[model samples]
Structures are given as C-alpha cells and as structure tokens.
Target: MQNKLYLDQRSNAFIILNLLMLWGWWMLYQLYALPVHYAKPYFALDKIPLYLEWSHLWFTTWLFVLLCICYLCTCLLLPHLQVAQVSVRWTLILSILGAGILNVMIYPVGAVDLFYYLTQIKLFAYYGENPYLTTFWPTYAHDELTPLSSFLSWPLVYGPAWLGLASLPIKFVGFDDLLTMLLAYKLFSLYCLLGCAWLIFKLLGGGAPGWYGAYVFAANPLVLFEAVANAHNDILLTLILLVALLGLRHRHILALPAFALAALVKVFILPLALGFAVALWRTRWPFRRIVGGSLCSLLIVFLLVAPFWGDGSIIERMQAAVEQQQTLRTAAPISLANEYAQTSGASAQQLEQLRIVFTASYGCLVLLALFFVRPLEHAMASIMLLLFLLVSSLFPWYLIPVFALLALHPRRLELGYMVVASLTGLLYYPLGVVAWQTEGLTLFQIQLVGATLLALPIVVFLVALLFQRRVELDQ
Candidate 1:
C-alpha cells in the first residue's frame, strides 16, 4: 500500500508539473487578462494575485493550463477514439478553420509587438525612408527623434518582402484604426499558421507520428500562444524554413526557392540556409543543381535589397546595415551580448572585443557541429542547428520554428528542448516580479541555476542512451 501511494504521488507530481507548464503558457497569452477560472467553484490553476494589475498575468496562465488539458484529453482519447479515421488532409483543414477562428478572437490580447511594428511601418510608409535608419518617427513629425527607436530597430529590420506584407493590412484597413490594423496583421500571420499546419498533417500521413509533432506543433503552449497570439513575424520565416525542409524531404529541387525566400526575409538565417544547402549537395543530386539554386536565391536577395543599396555601392549598404543592426539591446543574439556585458561590468570596447570573439567562436562551433551531424542525418541535423538558436535565447517567439518542426517531424529528444524551452517559453510561467526580485541573484547565480535546471536532465538523457545498448541486448 505504501509503495502504491508513492507511485501515485510520483505520477500526480509529473501531471501537476505538466499542468504548471501549460498554465504558464496560457498566462503568457492572456497577459493574465481573462480570468478563465473565475467562475469555477474549485479551480485547477494556481490563483494569481487578485489585484487588477496582476489579473491578466494569472488569467493567461490559467488559460494555458486549460488548453493543455484539452490537448492532453485529446491525447488520452486518441487510442480509443476513431477521430483520426478521418483523412489526414481533411483533419488539417478542420484544424486550420478551428484554430484560425479561435486565434482571431484572442488576437488583440495576443500582440505585444504591435506598437513597435505599427510605429516602424508608419515611418517607412509615410516618411519615404528606410525605417531602420530613422529609428522612430518624430512625435511632432518635424521634431526630435525618439530615443526608443534606437533600441527597437532590431525587430524592425526585416527584408522588403516582409516590408511589403506589413504595409498590406494598413493599406486595406486604415492604419488610423489600430484595431482593424492589428486584426489584419493577425490575418497575415494566420495564413502562415495554416500553411505550417497543413504541411505537418501531410508529413504525418507519410509516416511521422502525430503524437510527437501534431499535438505539440498545433497546440504547444509556445507556438500557439507566442506565434499566433503575439503576432511575431518570426512565424513567417519559420514557415518558409519548414516549407524548404519539406521540399527537400520530397527530393524536390524546389527546396532552393523556399530556402531563398526564407533568407531574403531575414538575413540572419542565411547561414542556416547555407548549412542546409551544403548538406543537400552531398546527396545524389547533381552539384550544378544547388549552384543554380544559390544564384537564384542571391539574385532575389539582391533585387529586393537593391533599392537600399543602389544609392551606394554594395559595400556602403552592407556597412550601413551593420551600423543599423547594432542599435537594439533587447532579445536574443544581441541580449546575450548585452547581458554578458552588464554582468561583466565591461567597458564598451571590452564588450565589443568579446562580441567579436564570441561571434567567431559561435560561428566556428556551429559550422563544426553542423558538419559533424550534417553528414550523419542531413535533415535532422540541419533542424538541430535551428533548435540550438531557438533555445539559446530569452524571447518567447524564437521557439516558433522549433514548434513548427515539432508538429511535422516529432522527435523524442524534444523532451530536452521541452524542458529548457519550458523554463523560458511554452511552460514559461515567468517568475513573478516579487519571486524574481526576492531571489536577489547575481549573474553567476543566474547562470548556475539556469544551467542546473536545463542541463541536468539533458545529461541524464545522454547517460540513459548509453545504457540503452545493454538494454537492447537483454531484450
């Protein structure tokens, strides 16, 4: 009886832990706004502070829990249920329609990037200038520039394809009406969501398990909440990357076009795209195939960027972009440097020195890791590089690509990604302001805690894999 009690306790604990993660994701979506559990006599969620200010935060948290439960129920019922007897393609169509309408309802509350996005678009559309350079439009239209623009430019600097897309909603919906504009933006992202879902469903029919990819991809706390709700443009790039991978999977040379589109949308992703290209070359495909692909991609990138570069030589535009990208201190890639400097108490020059070394080292390591694994499992390895970038950051939205892939490919080791990403993302019920402050942690303390939290389990998984050799023979 005692042993039975202990077993039940352990099971319940894990369930609770999963519930916490789901709730956290929901709260992130709600920003704690809708008290999803408000009417319940007995709530399954941890109650947020009753103060109106804390309301949105906790409410969203509860909603995340509810969504997870629904998804969990979906899973539990799968074995006994004949729901999947429906055709794969048809199931996807239903999901897109269901998920799309639900996302639209919560769309307003989902967006945190809206203000910055709107401001930047206005600067570009109305001012006839590169918005990345202008920082922010002057409040007076002829007055002093916004100090805020200097930092916000990082997310604003997408390629012309994105710039054109951003302007579309405002064109039809009137930027003066913030609500309509926001909805239009949501609709644009919605298209990407539906496309990604449809692709995942197609893959599952081909062989991949729906449990690993579909459940997590469509309903994962991270992807649904952050990508759909928050309206992050990263989803657009992620879908393109997924489409590229899917094309590659089918041995369609069309992967190059998809890869090119992704690269043109976001320059930072070119290295990742290039890595995938190299992996593709090792296959039976002729060498000239990718050479043609590369030229075409380069042409597209140049044509779109030509307006910005035509005023000066290619060298000049490249230099300007370098200057422009330096302006933001928040978010991944940059924030890693920002935090490193803040914690080190280093001068600007020292920080710059560290930045160069880290970038070079990171790039070399990434290439080495890519080459090492790329040859082993070309598709899986290339996707792993993207995962490396997604988790190595603090922002909630970076997981868009990982989650989308999870839906389509579904790996078991995602348990590692899930544990880490949950700490900062999907299961991300961020520490309360008081809980965070009261901890009074230094940078070193922060690193220690975070590393232990994320790494310990991953190390365990690695160890268990080694013992699996013995377990296999015993079986």
Candidate 2:
C-alpha cells in the first residue's frame, strides 16, 4: 500500500513536469514575437532591447541548460509512465491539446515557411492562378503582406497534392484575411498532429498497455515546436504516410494509392514508399497484384500533377527544385561540407559541382538500402537516417517522419532521438533577441556546432554496431 502511494505521487509529478514544459514552450515562443518583429523587413530596424540586456553567448548557455533539463526530466519520466499506464494516457492527450492551443498563438521559429504555404494557397484558390506558374513574391509584391516578400522569392516546388491539400481549408477561410487563412492552416496541422498521436497509440497498443511511445512522440518538445508552433506541412505529410503503413499492415493493396498520395505530398516519401512496396512483394504476393498497384499509384500521381503541369513549366519547376536543393545548408553532413568549402574560399562554380557530387553519392546510398533492407519499419528508419545525414537542409520539423518510424522501434532509437531533437532546437538561436544585437554566429559556425552535436550519436551508433558484429563473430 505504501509503495502504491509512492508510485502515484511520482506519476503525478511526471504529469506536472510535462504540462509545465508545454507552458514553458508557450512562454518562450512569446518572447520571439518582439525579436522577430524587430528583425523583419530584412533587419533594417533596431534590435529589441531585453530587460537584462543579455549577451548572445550567455543567453545560449542558459537556453542549453533549460533544454538539457527538459531532456533529463523526460528520460526520467518514461519508465514511470510505463508503470502508471492509465494516468499516462490521459496525460498524453491533455499535453497534446494544451500544446496545440498554446502554439496557435506563438511566433513561428527558425523559418517562415508557413507564410509561403499560405501564399501558394492564396494564389491557387483565390487568385485563380496556378501556383506553379506564379511565385508568391511577384504576385504579392505590392500587397500588404509584401514585407514577407523577401522570403517567398522561391517558386512553388511542393508537389501538386500538397497544393491541393493546402487549398481546401484555405478556400474555406477565404484569402482576403491573411491571419484567418493562417489560422486555418494551423488548425489543419493541429488536426494532423492529433491524428498522428492516435495512430501511434493504435500502432503500438498490441505490445504495451502504456502510452510510452505516444507520449514520447506527442509530448516531445521538438515535435511540438515544429508540428504545432511552426505550422509546417510535414505533419500532414507524416499523417498520410502513416495511413499508407497502417493500410499495408492490414494487407490492403489499396494502401498503394495512399502511398502515392503521400509521395505527391512531398517527393521525400518516395524512398519509404518504395521500401513499403518491396516489403509487400516479399510476402509472396502475386507479381501482377504488385504491378497493378504500382500502375494505379503511378496513374494517381500523374492525374494529380497533370492539372498543375504547364507548357515547359514542369521542366522549369524541376530546375528550380534542383537549384534550391543544391544551395541549402542546415544541420546535415552535406551542409558542413558545403560550408567548409565556402569558408575555404571556394567559388560559386566549385560549390555547385560539389553539391552535385554530394547529391549523387546520397542517391546511391538510398538505392542500396531500398534493395537490401527488408522490413518496412527498418527501411523507413534507414531512409530517414540517411536523409538526416545527407540532406543539404534539415530543420527540427524534418525529423517528424523519423520520430514516427522510430516510435515503432524506440527501444533502440528513442535516446538518440531525444538528444538530437533537443539540440536541433538551437537552430532558432539566430532568430533570437540577443542574436540580432550581436549579429549571431555565422551560418557556417552554426553548421559546425550542429555537426559536432550530431556526430556524437553517429559515432556511438557505429561503435554499437561494431560491438554487436564482434559478439556475433565470437559466437
């Protein structure tokens, strides 16, 4: 009886800690509003003065301490959650709802991609213009939202399915009011996030009675910030991908259309879809059935994209995507390489050539995995890991698919996810208050820091793999 009471008290504390973290995120994001406003119009304005006038270095130090504490608290709570099963389920649901509501009002962090999404929707739904043909910047250049023009210079490179999916709620809200349209998109993202949580719970329910995996995912600080606060469409992408996997698990071949739809949401899901298709084939399913599904998926993809396809514009859009991919630098190996080359005084032509080589090499690695990795979960994890390592640009939100895949097999990957995802939040430092005053760290320096942070996990994983191999050899 005494032990039971003690366990209940500990579980209560765990629930409170999670709720506090959600509230903390809301407060932290509010702090961004002042800084972001001051930096807008391309930093042509004065920096906002803080109460204590904190130095960038000191502020970053404190921020790191806070995040580390959050990570440690989360790690401590997971085991307790396993014991206090029923309580944890209610906590997960409450935490997600609380975070989603709070994030709806928070300032976007790291990137303003949300605004670009809105602009594309407005163009397609309201202006009756094909977003593929009209870049948001040129169309809205003289409009009231022109201050955002600087970031929307790039044309729509998102897939046709994304445009279609994004257009629905946008059309419902009507485009004359930007804030309402913004809220509509955010609400849509929130719906996807809630769906992901429920789906994860259903997927993992057979083995465990607890909401351990779902709690880790839904209540993850990075996931909350990216999925809810930033209003990224990646949440929607992950939702459809989960649908495909769930359908495949039930042996429903119609899952192929869902997978195709997922791919059309973003081409990034292609490798994972292919991996799923291969897994389906290995089950002794008939070749004709697989071929038929593939044909149907292809047809669906073609039909969705056909309306958006313009005279010679498809080639132009493809080129734009290639250019965008080549120039991007974020928390990935290629970003580090690209920055190293640039800081070494490499010319534009040399940087472009290097990007091509990096991309080609990354392609080969993914192809090897698609052919060799058999299990759908393992293959999806492998593909996402490759992306995390090889992509030229990665944001915290980019980790959603990875988090979803690893939630299925978190026994090994959860710790790595927590560490890396927590550190990835530091990417927003450049947008913070002190950063504007001090001009922040250079992009290359930030990449170096990220490389060092992520490399620790890479080394640890490789060492573990090598140790496991040695044990097998000894056996």
Candidate 3:
C-alpha cells in the first residue's frame, strides 16, 4: 500500500512538472513573438533590453533544467509503474498528446528552419518550381514567406519524400494565410512526433519497456522543442526510420523499400540502408530474393525523386545541397577548429585540408562500425553519435534519430549519454547568445564554449564506462 502511494505521488509530480513546462513554453511564446524576418534580429536579441535578454535566458535555463529532471524522473518511475493498468496507459498517451498540442501553438523561437521548410514547399506547390533545383531568391524576393526563410539562396537541403509530404499541409492551407500554414506545419510535425512515439511503444512490445521507450522519445524536452516547437523535419525522418525498423523485424523484404523511403527523407540514413543491405548479404538470403528487394528499393527511390528531377541532374543537385550544408559551421568541434584557425591567421587551404581529413576519417569509422556493430539498431545509434561528434554542422534536432534508436535498444551507457547530450546540445544556444552579445568576447572564445559543450557528454560517457568496468572487475 505504501509503495503504491509512493508511485501515485511520483506520477502526480511527473504530471505537474510537465504541465509547468508547457506553461513555461506558452509564456515564452508570448514573451518573444515571432520575428518579422528570421535573421540576426532573431528573438529580437539586439533590440531587446539587457534585462529582458537575461530574463529570457534565465527562464529558458530553468525550463531546460526542469525538463531534464522530469525525464530523469520518468526513467526512474517507468521501471516500477504498471503500464498494464488502463489508467496508467491513458495517462501516458494523454500527457504526450497534450504536450504536443501545446507545443504546436508555441512559436518556433529556437530556430527558424521551419520557415525555410515552408518556403521550399511553397516554391514547389504554388510557384511551379522544383525545390531541389531552384533557389528561393531574386525570383521570389517579394514573396511574403521569402523574407522569413533563412536559406533564401540554397536549394532544398532535404530529400524529395519530405518535400512531398510537407507539401500537403501547405496545399490545404494555401499560401495566402501565413499563420495558418505555420500552424499546419506545426500540426503535421506534432502528428509525426506522436507517430514516432506510438511506433516506439509498439516496437518495444507494450510492457514496462514499451512505456519507458515511448516516454523517452515523446516526453523528452529536446525532442518536443525541436520536433514540435521548432517544427524540424527530423521528426518526419525519425518516423520513417521507425517504420523501417518495424518492417525490418516483421517482413524482412519490406525493410529495404521502407529504408529506401526513409533515405529519401534524409540522405544520412543511406549509410544505414547500405549497412542493412550488407547485413542481408551476410545472412545469405537467396540470390533471387536479394535481387527482388534491391529492385524494389531502387524503384522506390527513383519514383520519389522523379517528380522533382526537373531538367537538372539530380545527382549534381544533391551534391550541391550536401556542400551547402557542410559550409555551415555550427556548434561542432570542427567549427571550433575553424574559429581558432581564423583567429590565428591559418590559411583557408589548410582548413580545407583538415576538413577533408576529418571527413575521410569519419567515413572510415562509420564503415568499420557498421561492419562490426551487432544488430541494426546499435549500428544506427553508434553512427548517429559519430555524426554528431565528427560533423561540422551540429544541431540539437540531429540527435532525434539517436533518441529514436535508443528507444529500441536502451543500453545504459548510450541512454545516459544521450540524456546528458540533449541538455548540452540545448546549452549551445543560450551560451552562444550570451557569448556573442557580451562585448570583447573573442570568436574563438565562443567556439571554445561550444566545443566544451560538445565534449562534456562524451567525457561523462567515458568516465561512466570506466567506472562501470571497474565495478564489474572488482565484483
């Protein structure tokens, strides 16, 4: 009876904390209205007074910490709680759904990538232009949504599958209504987020582990912030990846085509698909079955890209998009290295050489890990982590796949690392904001802080691993 009471109290506390976090987000939405233009004046960082800036920072920090606490509590409480109970199951479902809806209402104050997503879909849907081949600049300079898009000159960086799916809401809402379109995208993302959570729950076989996995993906603050609040397309990619994983387990042949479709959402998953193909070959599937699956996968990819192929070479356009993405030097170790190089008067050629080396090294590491890592999900998680660590353009939402994969195979070390990473990944934004605004702070100093944030999770993971090994040896 006492234990049951304790569980109820903890459950109630979890519900209240989530409500508080949602309220905080609502308040934040009101505090910082959507920007007229998504640029340097983002979140009105420059125009806002020092007090308001500090207030936003403090509020955001508190919410982040509170979110971490809630997630940690969920991790603890899930193991003991009886998810078999109807009320318990419904509570989990309703809480996730409620939080997602509230997040849809909140403006994407963290990043304006959603606007870019809208612009690309609008370009394709309304303007009769191929998003993959066309840039949304000089041509659509006066368009209402153009000013809001950060990537005005770059071609669509995402794959055709996402573009096609995202276009539906824009088509329904139409271009005349900007606010509605934004809401539509938010709603679309919320649905995808919910889909991911549901899929995770189903994949884990609907017990304690199922509930735990679902909560880990859905209740996570970072996932909510990026997937719903910011409305990133990573949620869509994650959903498709989960579908692919489900198919891989049930109908082996279905996995290939599903993975192909997933890669169409984001090319990063292509490596995993390749690894899957290799795994299939190693398993010694019949030659005819292998050929049939390969053909089906190819057909899916071809059909998805065919509509947007236009007159330009799709391969060339894809390469250009990849290059454009690489040019972005966000909160990654390479970004820090580039910053230091610039401050120290290092040559551009030298930096390029270093980048080449890093890229090649990462590619090799991924190949080896794919070959060696047992089980498909572990390989996916490991590769995603490698991408986060090695890539130059690191964003918080990129960790979405990591969280999704961890849901399937929740190892202690990776799970703990990712939970910590979600926090540190978010810290980059506020730290960058303060570092940039503070006078006399060097660019190198700013990048150094980002590098430190990037490194902290890895350091913690390593230390924990070492301690675990020591404990096992002592025993």
Candidate 4:
C-alpha cells in the first residue's frame, strides 16, 4: 500500500485526528437538531418539544439525514487516521471527534443499552422507587403515562454499582428529557474510554501500536456508536475490566479495587475474578487477607448501592434480583440452553430435557479450556470471553474489554475475531433505528459464524507455531 504524505510515518497523525473530530462534531450538531423538530412534532415520542420549535419538523428531518451521512464519512476516516502515524494533536482531535459522534448518535437513535439505562434511573429519580425493586413500568403505565417512555424492565440484570453510576446523571442531567440523560451517561463513558487508552499506553512502552489501537477501538464506528452514542454502561464496565486486566499483568494491588468494582457493576466478570483469586491464592496470601479483601470489595459496592435501594425488604429484593438475573452468563452452554428454552417457548419438560444436553456440552468446553488448550491459555480464556458475548445474552458494549485485549495482542487468528465481532456489534445499532420486523437480521450476520469457524483452524495453527517457538526458547 502506497502511504500518503504526512499521513504515513512522514507527517503528524495529530492533524488527521483533529480533522475527524471536526467532522464528528458537525454530525452531532445535526443529530441534536432533528428530534426537536421532527420526532416531538410528528410522533410525539417526546411529544413536548424542548430544543426546537415543533413547526420546524421538515427541516429537522433533512438535518438528521445529513448528519447520518456525515457520521458515516467520519467513521470511514477513523480507520485511515488510525493507520497513519499522526501527531498527538490530531489524535486528541480524532478522539474528541469520535466522542462527539458517539454522544450525538446515542442521543438520537436510542438503540443498544442506552434506553434501558435511562428508563431504569428515571424510575428512581422521578418517583423515588428503588431501581433494584422496581418491576416493569406497567404499574406506572396505567396513570395515563406512556409506557413507552416510563417502561423499563429487568434493571436488576445490572450489578449494583451500575445503578449508582447511572443514578449520578439524574442529579445534573435531570429528568427533563431523554437527551439530557443520554449525554450525561455518555460523558461518563468518555471518561472510561480515555482511562483505558491511558492505561494501555502506560503498560506498553513505546505505546501500543497507535494505528492498531485506533483501528480496533478509538475509531471503530461500532464502538463509538454502541458505547458513547448509545450510552451502554457495558462500555464503562468493559473499560474497568480492561484496566483491571492490565493491572493484573503488572500486579498492581491498588488497581484491584477497579476490577472488583467492575465486577460489582456487572457480574459477568465472575470467571475473570475467580481466575485472579486463584492466582492470588497460589501466591500464598493468608486466608483472612484474601477473604476479607473480596468481602470488603462487595461491601463497598453495597454501601454505594444502599442509598438508592429502598422499600424495606432488602433480602426479598436481593432474592428477586438473583432470580431475574439467572442467565447473565448465558453464553455458557447451560445458561444458553436456559435462555433459548425460555425465549423459544419450549415446554418445561422440553427444558428439562435440554438441560442435560446443555450441561454435557458446557462440560466439554470447560475441559478444553482447562487441559487440552494449555498452549493457548490466554487465547482459550479469550474464546470463553467471546462465547460469553455470543450464545449468551449480551449488551453490545459488553464486547469492549475483550476487543481491547484483541487489539493489544492481535495475532492473525484473533484479528479474525475482531473483524467478525466488529460487524456483529455494528448490526446491533440499526435495530433501534429501523423497525425490527422490517430489518429482520439477514444471513449476512451469519457470515460471522463462518468467519469464526474458518478462523479456528488458523487459531490451531497459531497454537502449533507458539509451541515451536517455546521449544526453541527452552533450548
């Protein structure tokens, strides 16, 4: 590939990053203008117009279309900017541009987890109901309130700390409108993304491959769209997980709180937590120190969560949370079967039959991860993580941490995971925009399954090569 001037190792990367930023901001401005004019006026989704005069509906629609095109252009530019060895100024500019586009799109489309995050918090803010104890908005929907706006279910699927963080926006952002809340959540997410970048830079001397970092994350349209644009708390949690993993690599005791807190925000990190705890145990920490530390982490999360949880019966609410969140690790074979059984409308008898099959399949994967997969321990752990993303229920932003790992440690085999995952994550965006029944996922999404399978052979080949390298090193 012929490299462009100043765009290659020749000139600064800072320039391109900034240019992308401007492009992204312009797109956001267009997004903010649209719903005020069109959505509120015509659909009355918000019905009450706050920003623009409802009469400007026609103009708002035009502006929204233009912004979508502009956002697309920005996305295309990011990959190139990432590949270029640009100056830091351009990098920051690009970073902000990425952030701008993310918040802009998140404010409008309402896809991904952005919706669930807001509605859950709004319940606590508007009515003073405990998010942990709240049921579907059906109770509120009857008071002439639109269920569409007030309706949220299963907020407890989120770990407790997530509720607190989501609640923080309620104070400053206010319950005045969804836009207010959307931006607030995204602002927090922006902080997380920056922290992840800084952490990666600190860990790897000479910096993680700049272009590689940008290409995999900083500039990926899917990441921007799902994380910042959509307000998925999973994005924030993913960063915490990444930071914690990097800390583990460095054996930073201080950073353990971040990982523990991450698990508090989302319980999906159970295996990673267990893995680390076991590693720690092997290092001979006293029983009390290990037990107390883990318990103390949970207690801290509870203290933060205590203010929001009310309605007395704490244990009942806790029990309810446990029942509702049963399938969080759904990609695990047993959990996947349970989810499939529930959603596919199978009979209880059928479910019981399927459980046996699921248990057996999961046992096989566990065995592979533990033993036969020794050479690719890291890679196997990663596969288990990816399996957690698929087969199980997952919010799009949940893919962020694993993607960070891949971006930092990309072998040819893992890059294949990146490409497929990036596409699947992108597909999630349109679900909120296009009518679901109309956009019904096509077979192309199936293309990822193919990529995964074909890529496995390469993964196996890579494993062989790594073993060879290890033998040579031993000599």
89-200, model 1: which lDDT tens digit per residue?
Answer: 3443454355554554453333345455666666667666675444563432442223212334342456666776667777777656556665777777777776776676
The prediction achieving the highest lDDT against the true structure is 3
Model 1 regions more than 4 Å off: 1-56, 69-83, 86-99, 107-111, 125-128, 139-155, 204-212, 313-344, 347-350, 372-393, 419-475
> Compared with the true structure, what per-residue lDDT tens digits does model 3 show for residues 38-77?
3332333334454354876777666677767666666666
* Model 1 error, position 352 (Å): 4.0
Tens-place lDDT per residue, model 2, 34-121, is 2345225322112334434556435534554464466457656666545437786667567668877776665554457677677777
| lDDT (Cα) of model 3 | 0.75
lDDT of each: 0.53, 0.67, 0.75, 0.52
Best by TM-score: 3
lDDT of 4: 0.52
List model 4 lDDT by residue over 24-137, tens digit each: 445544545433532231222133243245344434344334433433444334444543234643565456555544455434343434555666666666777776776546
Span of ten consecutive residues with least summed lDDT in model 4:
37-46
lDDT of 4 at 81: 54
Q: Give the Å error, residue 136, model 2.
A: 2.3
Those runs of model 2 whose alpha carbons end farther than 4 Å from true positions after fitting are 29-52, 55-68, 71-76, 82-86, 206-210, 342-364, 367-375, 427-443, 453-475
Candidate 3's displacement at residue 163, Å, is 0.9
TM-score of each: 0.70, 0.85, 0.90, 0.67
Superposition TM-score, candidate 2 onto the true structure: 0.85
C-alpha RMSD by candidate, in order: 7.9, 4.0, 3.2, 7.5
